[model samples]
Target: METEDMNTDRVRHVLTSLMILSFLIFGGLSAIILITDTPLTTSSVSLPFAFLFVSAMTLIVTGQIDERPKLTKKYLRQWILVCVFMVLVAALAFTLA
Candidate 1:
């Protein structure tokens, strides 16, 4: 029942999901490193946090917001808070590093 355009869109979605998964893996590894003996540098933590946040935002834009109304302003406000929180957390991570 699906057409060529549907298949292309599915492939794009799958590709984006793979990219996002990789970012999440990296972020989780960074967290694990921070928790373990070596500890994580400011950049170490920042890089992962930034990547994860960006990946999530991009997925939201590409899969939902631009094409649908799956998100709300209140949710967006919370997401912004999450971004700000990452900055503050990174700063603390730096001091601890």
Candidate 2:
């Protein structure tokens, strides 16, 4: 039972870290878009790169919080989905502005 609880806690921590990282990625991209006169394609193309970098950094930072957890496929999938969602939101914000 304790092992199960620990697994759950680890999952929660990973998810929370991912969520915060996603927000940071979105905010960073939005700031760049808003501040610069870059073309939309350039900004859009940069989102994935930013996501990759920030996600890696998030994992590194969060890993220190607990035993370094192996990133399972489930976590990878969730992070990808979050990245896609954040990119869509950033694009929409730029479009609407």
Candidate 3:
């Protein structure tokens, strides 16, 4: 039981670390886009915004899982859906760009 708990802790730590890194990167990109003088277009700004959204969602999921470690699977499923949404957003951005 102790080992299982430790493993889950480690997994959660790794997940949160990755999410933080992604959030920083995506947030930076979004900030850069917003800071620019160029006019914002759907194609020009959608991908970074989408990434920022997904990163935020993942952070939320990580928090939920941290509160109830047993719900890891449920949060993971949500993470997968968020990833799919990211891909779709990327495709749409490309099409529009």
**lDDT digits (tens) for residues 1-97 of candidate 3:** 7886787788678777877787787788777777886568777677676666766777787788789888777888888897887869777886878
Model 2 score (lDDT): 0.61
Question: Which pairs of residues collide in model 3?
Answer: none
Taking the tens digit of each residue's C-alpha lDDT, what string does model 1 give over 51-75?
A: 6765675465455433533343444
Query: lDDT of model 3 at residue 68?
Result: 87
Best-to-worst ranking by lDDT: 3, 2, 1
Candidate 1: segments with Cα more than 4 A from true spot: 1-4, 37-40, 64-97
What TM-score quantifies how close candidate 3 is to the native fold? 0.76
Error of 1 at 51 (Å): 2.6
Q: Which scores better on lDDT, 2 or 3?
A: 3
Deviation of model 2 at 55, angstroms: 9.5
Best prediction by lDDT? 3
Q: Clashing pairs in model 2?
A: none
Please write out the lDDT profile of model 2 over residues 1-97, one tens digit for every residue: 6785687577657666785876687677777866885666744645645565556645644454345345444455665676567667656654665
lDDT of 2 at 74: 48
